[model samples]
Target: MVRGEDRHPSLSLHLRARQTAEYRASTAEAERQLRDNDPDARPHRLQHCRGLRESGCNRVLGIINLENFERENAYGESELRLLTTIAASLGTALENARLFDETQHLLKETEQRNAELAIINSVQAALAAELNIQGIYDAVGDKIREIFKNRDMGIRVYDPKTDLIHYAYTYENGKRLSLESEPLGNAGFAAHVLRTRETLVINENMTQAMTKYGSYALPGTQVEKSSVLVPMVAGEQARGIISLSDMEREHAFGDSDVRLLQTLANSMSVALENARLFDETQRLLKETEQRNAELAIINSVQAALAAELNIQGIYDAVGDKIREIFKNRDIGIRVCDPKTGLIHYPYTYENGKRLSLESQPLGQTGFTAHVLRTREALVINENMEQEVAKLGATLVPGSQMERSLIYVPLVAGDQARGLIGLMDMEREHAFSDSDVRLLQTLANSMSVAL
Candidate 1:
């Protein structure tokens, strides 16, 4: 029975033994073929495999292993052909997958770039719509916070005239903070940016970065972990700086953040400059209007004085025109009688009511005598009572006390004919140099008329 079993080995056991023998023979033959072609063939580790190559290029993508054959001639042309087909299919599939992944990555990057551009366009539109500097600052601040997801930011305007950096806008942790203007010395991050006219991105160790740039933390400010500062450059000069900071996280800002903030700073610089030009234009326009108005008043005064035939009529006309020009009703005209040596009040109005005064000796001491003596215009904007007292003068009886005064000597061809005085009881320094010039022009016409 044992001999019979050895010869036909229980069918399953015989089949396994025969399969092992065939596999060994097939592996040996394959290894021998490889060795015959190449001396470096490691026959012990040989396996049935195929190269997964890319189409056309014939680039080997990878290797694919098939199950070892269990019989001689089992891995023949048909099996080799099948393995090659599988390898080709797998190579194409892997290439398609890689291409699809690359496409997806590129799509995501494009979408991110588009989003950033949209935000920048929105910010530009917001800034363009504003003509006020404060409005521009608010829009910029709000947009920066929205994009960065942080609330700490500031905009500083550099004033070349004063050599100072003014904090136009500042917010920290969602709270608005007021900061005073400081000298633009060489010791701050803003100063560094202004000096270099470049952007700065510090993602960690802000203090160390500042130190590297020869800068220091401002006395009342908290140091942040990360910061991006951009110069608001216009033409060749840096107009200001825009700074954004993160308090909790290092590396909060990156290259993209720096680029975006720099773009924003450029837009802000243009908007601010436009606002300034608009303000300057409006101011000049207002001054022109005021000058035109004053010229009109002076022409009317000249016409009125030219028609007056007598000295008193000229005085009355002068008083009326002075009231119209100054909007103040308290006015007086003191005429020096050259032959009589007396100063006479030809026309005087107090609080819009006419007043009569007796003639007095033209002494060397009072304000009236001083005007006639010096033949020059005098302005007293404060301490009128003390000033007049210093000039050896006293207020007329029943006269309202005045706080502001302008006295112009009426000179006719180098001779002081008289004086015209305008007073404002309510305010000191209420008159401008333009006012004095206008009054002097009127006095010249009065002197000619007299």
Candidate 2:
């Protein structure tokens, strides 16, 4: 221990004997207490020794027992730097082992989460690419199955017009299929979400609940236990539900599952909207193509017919075209001799170019005169009461028809030439904006052809 002594003087036989004795004593005491199940959480304490020496003929370091478990051990002024260095190395190694174990667990958890998120992203991508509404539903169902690694899944859609939630899709036994729409009430889970715009979950005995929304009470399936019902809310509207069910697992639907489902549901809302818009665009495109084909035919017919043709022939050709365009059950065209003040001609058809009733006189009626004066299309929607007031009966003199009428006057440069008319004989279907625009398209083109 003197200054300038050999750095690691070899331990003599006598010094080795003393150091070995101390090590055995500490080791025996530590083992005895641990065997007795002693809760001695403290680290082992080493005893101090003197008269120590390095073993001979060996590259060995000095061994000295220091006092004080903490205060004297830390390297500072008046410190044995080598002993302090040894303690520091051993302390760091132990801490490093604990830190490494902790990091391993964290990495494992993160990897699992990443894998699940990857599955979710793939599902969202598939849903977004769907151009048909049904396709999106199917993709969502399949994604749910894949994420649960081919487990079961289901979905519901809420329709505001019908005020009902309908089962739209389900995944069972690793396969997904469209769930035929089954009406569900506006109360319970549906109402809770609708009122609060919040999510709904029922994680109890799903099979025991005897309702349409209940799990596996599906009229075709056996009882299933725990289930989760998630609301697919979008655009201030409750679009659908994603219900999960299993025959086992009481803790299947927990807060964690609900939160994950919510995040997925938000993505689902976006996917649903994208799919709906893509579908609508495709439908509009197809209709546009059809309209263009019809216009091609009309242009050909227009070129063949002349400007000097009598009003009656123009009425016949235009009526035919209007029937093609509107596809109404009944359509009529009438011409009035303005100078003669008498009925000139009338042409009518019922459904797809069928030879309707015989040609009738315009009868110089005031209804014709009124429309001729206005030169504006008048549409009356389901006017049985109005007809009773005008025609003095529950119906008109027509063969057999109900519903409504659209009266349009042919006005070319302030000259009221004639009129084109229609009556949806049976279907009480209200006309939409597109329907009105289509009718106007036919009316405008008919005026030019006439």
Candidate 3:
């Protein structure tokens, strides 16, 4: 009501009562709706009506209800001035409270931010202390778990040569876990990450997440509620992936969590790259050493072959060097007589002992005969027992028979000259491709010497 109005005091009181009833009804309905929508919603705070204004300003901070002041008559000047003063005092207090609450919130936020910054710095420091992939992975897992309280994480290192994803490191339930490598085509979470080279954030059902990734969740004892898969990329190449998972909390990861993990992944990528380079360098060094050793063996064999020695002397010299080079003691050099059509074992060294096998017909009964007939190198292991039996071949005639054998045809001219056989009765697949090649080279040199 306007001041100094020619209106009845009864009318003014009736109008105020009606307005209060409407406000109560509206407030009750709003609270009911809110409670229905959210079971855990808080009760609505009481709000006062806006009535006071100074200097044409209408910014309402808060209000104080005066409904209990049951005045039947129109308010006089003294009561009006008192109500205005109360309104101004209430507005000032409300403004101060709002400012205080904001300041407290900002302080708490600053503390949280500082704590996160400290964690990042600590992780960076830990990462810096490591120069290898495994060490970096361990540092990341420990630091992240210490700060974020997560215990499940996995690091996969990609080997391009083998095209395999190797689980380099893993932590689960506060314990370090070791894992085996699998082919990249395996249908699992890590495999999918490696194939796609994309970061996957899963906060919902794991089955659905796996389906989205076009695979099933890798078999594990622990169930995961939320997870993140970040691909570790160095330059244009993807080195591996870091999988962060939570077994307990759904929606455990946030935008900030993803960013932190990505940062860790980037740092780990560089470290893995460094480790790969180091490994490659070591491998090259080893290859060079092996090459030098083989070259020296070849030179020694040539020098011995060129000496003015008899057939027995040549066989002894070659047998000694072959044993030294191959590090195998079971060796036999059989020379074939083109006229007699039989193989003659002039040199038979078995575990540093000389055995006498004067001569035998070149029939389909042994590996030497098979090589003499076919003129092809044959490398046989335990798996090739059926093939060896079909060939009806037995070179060494004892308990230490055909565990593994390599028979190379020695050819000097247009026809097969003889056969050189090496056997390993202790191990299967002990000889690699290089071993076969080097032995063939020795067989050729021996053929020429004969």
Question: If scored against the real structure, what TM-score would every candidate get?
Answer: 0.49, 0.42, 0.46
Winner on TM-score between 1 and 3 is 1
Rank order by lDDT, top first? 1, 3, 2
| Candidate 3 stretches greater than 4 Å from native | 1-230, 234-237, 240-275, 372-376, 383-387, 395-400, 411-416, 426-434, 437-450
Candidate 1 per-residue lDDT over residues 84-135, each given as its tens digit: 7887887787778878999997885675566456545654565567435566
Please list the residue runs of candidate 1 whose C-alpha ends up more than 4 Å from where it truly belongs after superposition.
Answer: 1-130, 267-276, 290-450
TM accuracy, model 3: 0.46
C-alpha lDDT (0 to 100) for residue 187 of candidate 1: 66
Return the lDDT, model 3, position 358.
55
Per-residue accuracy of model 2 over 307-366 as CA lDDT, tens digit each:
555655556666665666665547777666666665444676644344434434444334
Ranking by TM-score, best first?
1, 3, 2
Task: Quantify all predictions' global Cα lDDT against the true fold.
Answer: 0.70, 0.57, 0.66
**Model 3, range 1-450, lDDT digits (tens) per residue?**
112132222111111212233333332453344347555533332122233222234544433332212333334567656766876765565556667999997885675565456545644565466434455556655665665666577777888789888777777676677767767776667666666778888898887876765665444547688989899888887778877888888998898778767766776566557666775685677567566655655566567657766667767777777777777568878888889977778777766677786576777577777787778898886665677678886644443465687889989777898887887767788677766877777677666655
